[model samples]
Target: MTVQSIAGPRFSWRGPSNGWRQREGRGPTLALALFILVFSLIPVGRLIVAAFEGGFGAFWQVLDAPDVWRATRNTLVVAFGSGSLALLIGVVFALILSVTTLRARTALAFIMVMSLMIAPQISALAFKTLAGPASPLLKLVGLAPAPGTPNPMLGEFGIIVVMGLHHAPLVAITLASGLASIPRPLIEAARLDGASPWQVVNRIMLPLLRPFLLSAALLAFVAGTGNFGIPALLGLPVGYVTLPTLLFRKLASFGPATIGDAAAISVLIALIAGTGVIAASLLLARSASRLETDHRIEPFWELGRWRPAVEAGVWGVIALTVLLPLASLLATSLVPAYGVRLSPSSLTLAQYVEVLFRQDLTVRAFRNSMLLAGGAALSLAVITLVSAYVLDRAKPKVKAFAFALIELPYAVPGIVLAIACILLFIKPLPLIGVSIYATPWIILFAYHARFFAIALKPVMAAMATLDDAVQEAAVCDGARLGQRLRHIVLPLVFPAVFAGMLMVFLLAFNELTVSALLWSAGTETLGVALLSLEDSGLGAEAAAVAVTATLLVLVLMLAMQMLARRLPPNALPWQALAGPDRERRG
Candidate 1:
């Protein structure tokens, strides 16, 4: 009976009696361990070495600088302020969409997701153009200030606003996921007790959502602390510097000579991000009890007389957040030059044509970004599949550590990752006698390190759902590990594998912070090129490039939407919204 139970009718467990147990080796596990160490650990280790290269001397210098302290102050202020604003916005929207009978919920949710994708720099750039005296949108409405008025978007205030708006959707999505786990019976019971809707929400829902709100705030704070593009574009011109912008300016002005100081700054950023992650982890652990229920709460709030007003308000916010600014950006891009009024008489596709066709640098930047992002996506897909397989077979403790290693680099700011790559590869390799610094190779390495977790998520999700009985049956037939993987595991998880690849490609293609410090003359990326154009005062050209990049991302998102049906549940980040949509329609 024991033997029959151990080796079931269709499949047999790995045992001494089966040759399958003998066929397993440590080769795959060893290879995966080495891959994780090289990709995740070495770069971080090099960052630590670079931070202390001069043995506490760099630390002393960094500590003594007044500007460094000011930047630190600014970083903290921005993080907390933006985080608070995001939390408020996120909580309100999440509650409205998740619990109410509001119309067009899907449309509103889609707008919010798009808002999150409107890269930080582009958001800043769009708002800057929309507010300037020369702004076509403002001027057309006769709200333009005088020509000499200082741009309102050139300071810390603008940074805070853009950061808050950019991250509000992220917080909303996180909180909605938490809300989905609440049991409907709890809320229904509260309502049946004659409690008012507001009373039920205030007394029952808020306490349950406290943990998720804190998690959202911490994530927003971490995002603000590491944000480079927003501050670099909006804050740097007016001298309102954050740590990330300071690091970028240091690297740009001093080049390799300031490596030690830059490394120290990067270390400060890592410390800030690390603290936030740890705090979020602890808060999540404490609130782990709230997520124990499995049944999701259904949408129960009837808007009654207020439904129309609520729908209008939600659509209005979406238009303000995504449509208005993007349209202004497009209008600016169509003008002949910066500050030119956008009208039929002045409109020209000259800038777009130049960037897309005539400009060698822009063309090269596009090519480089595509190649690097594409290469990283493909490479990470293959690597993550193997790593996921090994992780599935590992002990719990080993699996946890391996998972942590994958997430560490992603949680670290992109600038910090770039600094780590510089530290690791700045010197000539001992055997190769060549340096990867100032080359596209360094950018590729940073992408690999920073996006490892992103590429692993869908694969892990797919692996969790896989049936092990088939693999065991194959093993019973004397199948080798490679044969089982090729014929069984890969086929089961290919959808998720491809989904992860596409996600990595989309993220890496528009990424700026990692490539900001790493790109050289011949290795410019789309993000670097866009920023460079704006910094050089070619605002129209920059806007044109920004518009093009935005369209590319939207196209990819549409492609993903079309493929959503074929992919695994929750494979795409936005697929979770489908459930809410169906509920609303029904």
Candidate 2:
């Protein structure tokens, strides 16, 4: 019964640094290392190198250019404007749902996040169709502006509003994490001291949540600077330009020679984003921001008299921002053309029919997108199994570096990755002499790079939760590494891995920015095709494409929701937002 007897004489203690690496994980370690280097490291390095090809001459030259300077200023302006709006909206919603007695929190959170889940281009399109003189929906309501009038949703105002609405959930979700950590006793103590709810929040909560506010603000700003779909659909038709759209336009207009200039601009954007991230981290690290306590989080703000009014206002905002735009998109899709008012006789399914079944480009786009998205998700899921395992045994510094590298592909703007991909693959492989540059393989590669961090995250988190003793016992019992992985590790983490794959697919499926820059003839994704149809004045067809893409995303998200019941808490983010009261969260 003693320890020496409980463990056999042959039993040896294992630590992260000892038996795992000494015995089994080398293969997976090597595999994940290679994967990271190829998919994440090379593209980023190539982009940085390309930007400084002439030893900072071209870099400084691009930064000094009038167009570059203008675009940078515009990006800063839009980012600031949109981030401010998003901060206001998101903070209001988060406080209401997380602290106040708000009804329909789940439904409201779902709708808010859905705005983000739907592609930014689709959101832009929906808002666009709900405005202007040519709007079929507005025309039916007799609210359409006079003919020849410009779309109100076509410049800085529209881009800022639309982008703010689309990104508000991001700000909300970030702050929700902060909000969930608040100790219940603090609020109780304040209430006992005769402090009003608003006073408590202003005096205590706001001070504690400064780190989250800073993080949320910087996150929104970075997202706005990197956003392509909103500006593309909203700002590009006008003279407005941001860095992402500017880089996209240059590459699209001037051809291959512009890649170098695009790289310089891309570097500039990456630097800005990087600076914000680093500053946020430094501030958070330096500040005494920890809020951990034994007390559970509980809502103390009871809106006894104002509940109904708040509900009405919330729903009214939802109607204006969510329901109306979506209804307009669907209505416009049903019509014969952009300006064709919706009526019994004017309704036609031709656009859906054409985009879904008939048009060659549309057909090819669907095929290519499905293949790219599916391929990337499947690839990342498999990659995560190995990468997560490797990282579980990796030292802290190595794991952190690996994670940061994986995130770089997604953190840097899609346009930067697109330019880097072009640079990296423009030449044939050194040995294989095979080029994937303009091929579907290139897009697939981009998806893997951009989404690998997302796929690895959930799996790594799940991996950390696993019982180390069980795996160690398996090792002690002479179960081979692969066998333990197949039987013990896989079943436990499968839910997380699947969740990661679903997230990757969801993000990759509706992606536009990366594919927009990287697409070629016959290789267009649904996003690219939607943009093409819209640019060609085929508004109905474009709406059809957007609606189709949104439906697919909805179906996949629904599947994830269904699967979420059996999975860990917060496996799907909407689940966390859906029911923050389900458990005593840390």
Candidate 3:
């Protein structure tokens, strides 16, 4: 199982003849585990404890509230509706781009993935600006609602639509990974039997892709259920509240007095998300027996006459999902005021100039977001290096436990993690006597809890590809643990560590959900700041900020695209679509 790096030094491995306990020093490993426990396990444990602190009656009372039932129903509705929409969109694009001769698929996939990177609040804002009374884009086309019209994107329907489109790429990427593993010969045999494209998909491909499709659906459900940004911006204004927003509003108006009730609501969210993840795992395992180990695959479909139409349709989808909303955002930003139509006589860059320079709050937000995201990324890079090493070498059961603990916080909705942080940090520290509940530090703590898994998973993957024999060789050469890690292990896995850092940075930078609840006036993040401006009737300025932030993400994405080739396969999720292998297969 040795994997030699194509560019870097060769990595080789052999089985450890010894038990899980290695002769390498255990200090870093112990420290890493303790750090994970404090960040990952303790917060969740505290939230759960607080939920029942007032006895089981409190849990039942919270559950019995009419709002809880309403939120629960709304949560389920959005989860199912969005999950289905995302699946439908994701599977179609995945199959076409992966199997058929669709032109510009690489660019299309890139744009669709860009949708995922846009913070949910930003996405909601863009769409909100596209169709409401304030929509310049709609006004120019004579499609804008009247001046007194309520925003069309401010209710249950809007939440479903935005979330569905937002999560579509997640489904597409997951299904694409599975599609890549399908043996080409299977599809070829069916085609040779006089099967039409649809027939082949129905009788051969779909069956094999069942587990992946379900897995994607489950992931979308989990995402939608825990989502705060989309629901917060779209739902709150229309009085359509989901669990995450409900919890947030409850805490906001009632303050610390509602901690027990908030924790109870948080527990409900945890249960819903946890169930979906467990089901996905079981579904994947049940279907594992059907997947062959050999992964050689070739493109299996050709839409020769229909290629133009299919490609046009995909681009149309991209326009709707990515271009239109962004264009609307830009158009709105250039207006002299909110609800003003854009034209030769009316266009201006005043909003952008204001947010970028005149407004100290906006400027402070940019600094805070960068500082928090940058600090978390750097810290996780070091922590994950050691954490991944321990996970790679630990016994199977222990490894599973550690992995779950790492993933639990992330798996729950961001709102749940924020609540957990609130419950854990509301009071002063035993020795330090400082409260972080209203400060930037609390947001940082929540970021670490939610994103540690994002940083750890990639490094663990890179570690798995390394052969144990390399490490054993270092051990035999009288190199101690620290020396081996520095001279051999870190160098081999540094690429993954670097990739993880960039991913975590990008994600945390645009993050809104955790900070939405934890942020005080001075602690506002980019997301919180944008929402605040919008809420305060500064829609044009918010649009300006949204456009600015999106441009920054686009730049980071371009950097990632440039770096993809030198890194290992699958380093960037979009690499598969952009690679030469795709062209050859097509």
Q: Identify the leading candidate in terms of lDDT.
A: 2
lDDT of each: 0.83, 0.85, 0.84
Estimate, for each residue in 98-174, the C-alpha lDDT of model 1 and write its tens digit.
88887767667767877787678888888888887888778767788999998887887888888898888888887
User: What TM-score, to 2 decimals, does candidate 2 have?
Assistant: 0.95
Q: Considering TM-score, which of the candidate structures 1 and 3 is the better prediction for this target?
A: 1
Candidate No. with top TM-score: 2
- Tens digits of lDDT, candidate 3, 386-407: 8888778666677878888888
Pairs in clash, predicted candidate 2: none
Estimate the overall C-alpha local distance difference test score of candidate 3.
0.84
Q: Taking the tens digit of each residue's C-alpha lDDT, what string does model 2 give over 139-162?
A: 888989999999999999999999
lDDT minimum window of 10 residues, candidate 1: 1-10
List TM-score per model, in order.
0.94, 0.95, 0.94
What is model 3's C-alpha RMSD?
Answer: 3.4
**In each prediction, how many residue pairs overlap at the backbone (N, C-alpha, C within less than 3 A)?**
0, 0, 5
Runs in model 3 lying further than 4 Å from the true structure: 1-22, 467-470, 576-580
User: Could you arrange the candidates by TM-score from highest to lowest?
Assistant: 2, 1, 3
